[model samples]
Target: MSPWTMPLVSAAVLLLTGAVLVALWLWVNRQSWTDQEKRTLAQLEVVKVASGIALGGGGLFTLYLAARRQRTQEEAQADINADAEARRITELYTKAVQQLGDDKAPVRLGGLYALERLGQQQPDQRQTIVNVLCAYLRMPYTPPPERAARSAKGVHRPLLRNSGRRAGIRRPEGQSPAAGLVDAQQERDVRLTAQRILVAHLKRGGESWGELDINLDGAVLIDFRVSDGLFRAATFRGATFIGDMYFLGIFTGFVSFAGASFVDEANFGGTFRGVTRFSEVFFGGEVAFSGVSFAGYVTSFAGASFAADAIFGETEFVGRTHFRDSAFSGRAGFASAWVGESAIEPGSSWPAGWTVSGEATSRPGRDGHDGQWFRLVRTSSAAPPRPPTARS
Candidate 1:
């Protein structure tokens, strides 16, 4: 009931009780009786009032006890239901993980889907499921030789002939090494499926897994792409990216690609809000960072190598930036790039021929577009650095 209405209701009940009491007193006074009878009638009236009060109080107490009991029962039921749900989730998770260990590729794919579905249903378990997938990718794996390489010069070469035996791939007495290659191919497909599952949920919009940290250290990613993703933190240290890589997203926390290798073209256009690293990275194909914003404590590309064109046009560096010991075999460009005045750290190095302009221009601040900004320009016609030696 409303607070205002409750007071009115109580007042009405009080008035009704007063009126009934006054009527009973008047009736008793109007009756002509002796003093003894009058005293007896008064005693009877008192007893009746006391009995009514006792009954009414008892009824209210009973209602209070019943309501409390009902509340307790409901809470108990809710607890039981919650416990059952938790058990069900645990069972499903265990089953899916077991399936992942199956020898058949189809079974492994099914397990990936099962885990994906579980994550969608149970938001709290999403990170755990993602960790499992990353672990699977991190497992030692050697991709099957490309079809072109195997068929080159009309020779049937089995790339995993010796390793397959060591890996315990059972074969018939006269089975050929090609059987092991087929198994490798199957494993590759399973790994690719896991990668797809991760990319599907990491991207922005439709069923996106919000701001999860990803750790794929030393993992091999084939044709990885993170278009429009939001990461809290990520690590890809010593990872290998086969085929093209696309990283168009936002990193709100620390991100590292140190000691990584990109075998194909890499296109990076995103906003890095925390410390970013690319130390000792190798880019076998063209790499571009056009229009990218690095707003972090430090952005390093130290000891990195670019075998093909390295483009950094219109890039913004809002914090300490480093390109020390970096090598570029092909053409390198930094046209119209902006760096904050406080971003240049002592001993920080740029490309051999490139230098920051003497005049500091006004652009937006870190939050806005106007602030003190310096442009990078080519001051000399020096040759680009020689490519680094090939890895062992």
Candidate 2:
């Protein structure tokens, strides 16, 4: 009940109780009193009852009003405090983002840490901060000039500079890193730190792992390691890996690497639970997918080029695995690779020149090299004398 209503009701009850008492007294004394005496007793009774009821009711009403006023004041103060806190958080966020564009590497690192703290404190800002870090990584970056000169033609160029043995960061004014003069080693350190931040937070059951998607298109990852990691939907389209790229023991959401280039040896020995696309990707070094499993709805490698040996030993495909129009300059191996029931329909997306020799189980060749796999195995001729093996 409302404060005002309770006091008013109490007053009404008091008045009624006084009236009832007066009536009872009059009825009891009617037989032993004269009319004047009865009138005097009734008048005195009414005065006394009225005074008591007035005082009690007025006191209760006053108390209720006071309490209501105090509560209102407290609520108003709480709102003001909340507004001030929100403004403080906003100011902090703005300052951190501004520091990300500073020329000094140390300042940029500080900004990254500040944003990370903000995300940890505020769950709603975690994904946004992660996106900012990814954006920084995606900025046009290349290896040092000395390393770039050693790379082959059409490779992703390197642009980051190095001051000394220690690393730093350089994000000049504007969005692009083209005009930014970066120390190669220092820039690599900053990028590594940024990657570490994401890795630390994106783990399962982590305090800051939200349902977020990672997009690192056109990023330059020199010698990074994402092995044994768990990620949500992610895309590294058009990204370049300068050194050995290890994707072993990784469990990921829908993944994509369309047009990505791996300069050195690449290992994809992991399990992909969602769609895995690698269309138009170029593998410059030896690629090993041994013991890899693709349970995704669709796994495609259309138009991919393998300049070195491509190994798929013991790889299992639980769903569609496509390799249409793919080129392998070196020997390709798919020995002991199984096609589960979900992907029984073989040769659906194979190259036109390749053929499947076994309907159910493919046997190894005389030298234990050539094995008839489920669908796609590209040999120089229609059926070569000696085909590649698991060890090839």
- Worst 10 contiguous positions by lDDT, candidate 1: 148-157
Q: Which candidate wins on TM-score?
A: 1
Model 2 Cα lDDT, one tens digit per residue, 290-382: 878787878888888888888888776667778777877776776456665456575446533454435655544221223444643544444
Predicted candidate 2, C-alpha RMSD: 10.3
lDDT of 1 by residue, 82-105 (tens): 999999999999999999999989
Task: Tell how far residue 336 is off in model 1, in angstroms.
Answer: 2.4
Candidate 1 collision pairs = 363-370, 363-371, 364-369, 364-370, 364-371, 365-370
TM-score of 1: 0.82
Predicted structure 2, TM vs. truth: 0.68
- Model 2 clash pairs are 142-158, 142-159, 143-158, 161-182, 161-183, 161-184, 162-183, 162-184, 167-186, 168-186
| Candidate 2: regions farther than 4 A off | 1-78, 146-182, 205-211, 248-252, 351-392
